[model samples]
Structure formats: C-alpha cells, structure tokens
Target chain A: MYGIRHLHLRNPGSWSPFEELERLQASLERGGVALGGASAGPAIDVWNEGDGLRLRALVPGVKPEDLEITVEGDALTIRGTTAVAGPQSGDRWLLRERASAKFARTLQLPFAVEADAVKARVANGVLEMELPRSAAEKPRRIPIQTT
Target chain B: MNCEMKNGCATVAEPTVAKATPACDVWEGEDGVHVVAEMPGVDAAAVEITIERDVLSIRGKACLPRASSRAEGEMDAVATGYVRAFHLTDTADAGAIQASCKDGLVRLLVPRKQPAQRKIAVSTG
Candidate 1:
C-alpha cells in the first residue's frame, strides 16, 4: 500500500544473489498492484535493532479492533480498514478529501524471528511491532581446543 | 464572504507560522460545520485548540519515539509535527463549538445559529 514508499534496501547480509532477484520480481509485482490507486495505505518506518527489528506504521482514524496482523514464515502482514461515516441524504458536503479504504502490506524480514515472541501495540494511531530474532539465528561463542 | 475592502487590503491575516500543516477535511450539514484533522503520533494532552473571533487555530506536537542505540546511522531524524488554522465566517456559532480526539484524529463540531423568523399580521380591508 502507501506505506511502502519508505522501503529502504539496506545490505541485509543473509540474502543471496538469487534471493535478491526473487525479491526484485516480487516487488515489481507489488508495484503493479499499487499503481492501480486502489488504496493508499499509511506510512511506515522500519529500523534494525541489535537483536531484532522494529516497525512503526501510522494509521490515523483507524480503530485498533479493525487491524489484523499475521506472521507467516519470514513475512509479516498487516491488514486493516478505515471507515468514515457517509453523509446524510440531505447534507451537502463542502469538502471531501478524507478517504476510507482497506489496505494490506506485507514485508519480508531479514532474519528468521521467534513468531511467538513478537510484540505489538497500538498507540496514538501508530502500530509498533518488535520481532525478536530466533534462537538459532542469534550469535554464539564457540570454544577452540588447543592441540 | 467578502473578505477584502475597497483599499485592496485583506481583512484576515494569513497564517504563515505553521512548520507543518496537517491534512484536514471540512464538512457542512444541517447540524452545522464539522472538521476532521489527521494528527498521527500526537497525544491528546499535547493538542491545543483556540478560537479568537472568527479564526480557529489548531496546534500539536508529535511525540515520536527515540531511536534505539543500534539505529544510530540507519534512521533519519525528521520533523513530524502539525499546526493549522482556518478563518471562519459569520455563519458559524463560535460559542457552541465542541471537539474530541481519538485514534490520532481530531473532530470539531461548530453548530450554526438559526435565523430569527418575524411574523406579519394581515387584516381584510
């Protein structure tokens, strides 16, 4: 949706050249749908944490109850609808710029995360999510045996 | 709606002090005029609304979260605040205005005053 406008392609060390091609292909497909002007979603900011990743999405005028978040594999999806009440039959509108529509955005995480450990909260129309890295993906120290 | 005088002087002073103007929508109906503005990341306590004569003003500061230690070079610091004002007309009843904020959206209702109707007496001559 509209939030993808701020997607920064940082050097995520894990992706291979072949995976990059697949990601480019998927982004092109998403661009095709986004160009239709169906839904201009909210703005989002993604940042890298030491042991995890954090995401913040701005969705004003949308109720928390209407949001649906799902994590599948390495992808995180957020779906929600903003509904504004229609004007009455006899009412004449002076201005009508506000829009109401359904939006869905999916982002591929750089590393595998603990699905159950993910934390999310909605405050002041901003959705904040913290995805902790999986145990297997965390760095560990290995001991060396002297000959 | 005549906002100018014969001397070519503007009656209302233009608002040029806002750092960032937020998106706003105004609707007119039988009840009166309703205004909705989007102010994401702003808390209700930080919002300020005032009405001086025919001018309605809105100002708020966005409470953005600080960057984590690991995101020193990855994130950019940008201003995400809003300030806006509107010149109202005589049709608006400034005294009866009401406002509320929820989900980072502020809604203002300004009720219109009803015009007084005069009764005329008729007699057969």
Candidate 2:
C-alpha cells in the first residue's frame, strides 16, 4: 500500500484538496513502487510480516559503498549509482539495456521501523533488508478474564 | 553438443514454463564481443553457461526467501530461475570464450576468430 488511499489519477482536468501533497508523494513513490505507472528505479519486493517488513531491491554492479539508505518515520529511501562495464576504453556498444544512472527509491511502510534492528546488505546486485517494527508501533496482546 | 534442434539448445527448452529474462548489455571491443547481464539472487555456483556449436546459453537458478507477500516486476522467475541464450556470429571464436559470474552479474566474452595465416613461396624463373 502507498499509505494514502485517495490519489487523483492522471487526468489533466482533475484536482482535489490534497492535490499538492499527493502529487509530491506520488512522484517520490515513482521510485518506490509502480502503483499505476512504470517504476523509475530498481524493482522492489516488500513483504509485510507480522512484526515488520522484508525488502529486496535489484541493483547489479553497484558497490555497497555507493548505496545510501535512510529511514524517516515509516518511509525508507534507497539511492545508488552504477558504472557501466566495457571491454576497453573505446569499445563499441552493440546493445545497452542496463540502467546506468544515479537512482533513488523511497517506500512508505505500514509501521515505524526499528532503526537499530534493521540490517541491510548487498549481494549479487541486490539489496536486501529486514526492517523490524518499532516497539511502540507493535501491537500488544491484552489479557482477558471471564466476567 | 555441437549440433541441436532449430532453437540451438541441446537441453530441452520448456515451452510451457515461463522464465525471467535478465537485463543485459552487449558490446564489441577488445578481443571480441562482451555481454553483461544483471541477475539478482543468482550466485556464481548457481550460474550455468553452456556453448554448443554457435549458441551460448546462460541460465541461473535464483532462490530467495519470500513468503505470503506482495511484490513487483517479474516475480515468476524468482522460483523457476532465469534463462537466456545468444547465437554467436560466424566471426566469433567459441574456443576461447571467457565467462565469469559475480554478485548476481554475469559477463561473457567471445573472442574473434584468428585469420588464416600462410606463407607464399616465391620462385625466380
């Protein structure tokens, strides 16, 4: 889920009270998930678990040092830059299909992430993370007695 | 597997099952043609590259843990794996093909064939 329930679809003539904020959120989400359009950044898979979320993003050839991950509230942002490979300096390219750019994606999760418990690592051109839910955001089981 | 069916694969290509097509870049330079592909979740040990006749096949089984989830992009191959193959040109030399897989990325180089060399004898009449 993109957090917001109502969003003005891309109809040029449409406008609403939350239009400005929705537009900004939608644009930022373009990097996060493909809600209704093509994703500008890497493909991501987010699983909403009972306690937290598991996220995976494809980023081949991107080194760990080149990535920047930051979390604020329920939103998590992933940014990276890639270097295109070549046989030599003056090699002629026959086909260039891979993305070679500075890209960033921000995702809005359902619960606040425990920053200390979150562990992220890059392997085989993919970024994987486990975001544990904050204690305050976790649901507590209340005891009940027969009355 | 020097020769095969029209598809160039000695191993049977499963027509019923769909596989993930990896994103790749092909360039001609240095000794020959080089190809690079982005295949996340695939490891070096899991990558399979086969050359039969003029066909170069790349297949990798990518296994990732995801249970009861909502995802995006081509998720089918996450369980089934990735399948891709290339037909080599006549000028390419298959004998010296060099390939390496690292961190879910595969790079292949097909060197150009060396030209025939022969010395012509000159006679004085």
Candidate 3:
C-alpha cells in the first residue's frame, strides 16, 4: 500500500486533496463573487486545433435561439440570455447559485479568421465553434535556387 | 428555530472541494423541491443519483472528445465534472424523486409531502 501511494505522489497527473484546495483558492481569487452578481459573462475557452480554431462556452439552460455568435476579423463575440425563474409566492429559495441575466463576451483570436466559413452550434448548454483561417492569411512559401 | 426544516434547505456549508460546482439553483415550492445544476458537457446518460439516510447526491460526468495523445500516453485534455449533495427532510418523498437532464442541464424534483391530517373519535362518558 505504501509503495502504491508513493508512486501516486510521483505522478504529476494524479489528483490530490491539497491540489484541489489550491485550485479552489485560485478560482476564488479570480473573481468568484462575479457569479450571479447581475450580468456575468459565461465561461469560455478557445483553442487552436490543427485544422481550425475551436471555441466553447458554458451557458447551460440557454436556448440555442437566444445565443448570437459573431466573428469579425480576429475577434469573436458571444451573446446570450440565461434565465432561471424566480421563486413564486409559495416558493422558497434555498440556494441561488444560477441566475437570470444577459451575458456577452468578446475575445481576440491570435490570427486572421475566415468569418464566412465559421461554423457554430449550441448543445447541452454548451456552445462550440469552428473558425477557419482566411486563405490570404496563410503563410506564403518562397523557393530559392543557386547557379 | 426549526432545525429539522430539511426539504430544500441547503447543506450547512458549501463543500470546499467543489472543484466544478456546476452552478446550482435549489428551491422549495408547493409542487416540490427542485435542484437545477448547470453541467456543460454532461449528458442525460452521464448523470448519477444516490441517496443515503437523509442525504441525496447528484454527480455528472462530462464527456470530452478523445484527448490528443502526446508522448507516452499523455492526454492533452482533462475532463471537468460536476458534483453536489443535499440533505432531504422527512417532508420530502425521497422515494418518488424524479430527475431529468437536457443539453447539459440536470434538473431534480423531490415532491413534498402534505401535512397529514387525522380526526380522532370523541368519547362520551
């Protein structure tokens, strides 16, 4: 048992209770109170894949019709509404972590984008987009010959 | 103070280990107690619910596309999941709790038990 535990300690990918606490602390420091404070933007992640750039946003309960995705030049913007009905006369709220508000966020991409070819979809409360690079933006190669 | 007020009362404190708490909204209403959690990558088939004693727990596993394998079986993408637990009061019919998931949202409903009323026969001496 001790040997296995020691092996886990050496594995960087393994999760530990201390690391979880540190992660929680780090998140709290990065504006934890912004959540549910009125009009907080949804969490978004954008990454560069080999074929194109991919972006995803966390917007649970947001109907697809309510989301508007736009890409201009190298900037991408997502706008949506998240609404959780308030408690009625006989309803008593215990926890209100989720909120009802309009959220909008824009992020700049690292390279030129082919806005016309961008594809976007929302599913299971998540929005995903595939952004291609413009043909003219691709790097041109030069060849040289020695006599 | 009604310490026994259980149905929709949140557990005393937020568990510090809520790595991805999956923003939740819990409420108690005439219909029942409802718990809605926002779990981005989770699907209807990926949710799990369990009950023990007075506690009810919800866990959802988000499914990500196969991570790009780097050198030596190293994965580039890590899955982040959502988990939370609640304490159910006697007023809730734990046996009849219903849960549903859509597009990445999980909603749970625990029906409330109406206060039982009884009539006692009068004894004439």
Interface RMSD over true interface Cα atoms for each candidate: 13.1, 15.7, 13.0
Q: State the lDDT at B22 in candidate 3.
A: 64
Where is the poorest 10-residue window by lDDT in model 3 chain B?
A: B1-10
Q: What's the true lDDT of residue B24 in model 2?
A: 74
Residue-wise C-alpha lDDT for candidate 1, range B30-86, written one tens digit per residue = 787777777877788878888766567776677766555544322322337666566
TM-score of chain A of each: 0.68, 0.68, 0.69
Question: Lowest summed-lDDT stretch of 10 residues in model 1 chain A?
Answer: A1-10
True contacts kept of each: 0.28, 0.35, 0.32
Error of 1 at A128 (Å): 1.3
Superior by TM-score: candidate 1 or candidate 3: 3
Per residue, candidate 2 scores C-alpha lDDT tens digits across B11-50 of: 4345443356677777777677788878888888888888
Backbone clash tally for model 1? 1
Instruction: Give a tens-digit lDDT track for model 2, residues A23-78.
Output: 57755655554333323567677776657888887777888998899998788888
Error of 1 at A22 (Å): 27
Segments of candidate 1 deviating more than 4 angstroms = A1-38, B1-19, B69-79, B116-125
**Candidate number that wins on lDDT, 2 or 3:** 2
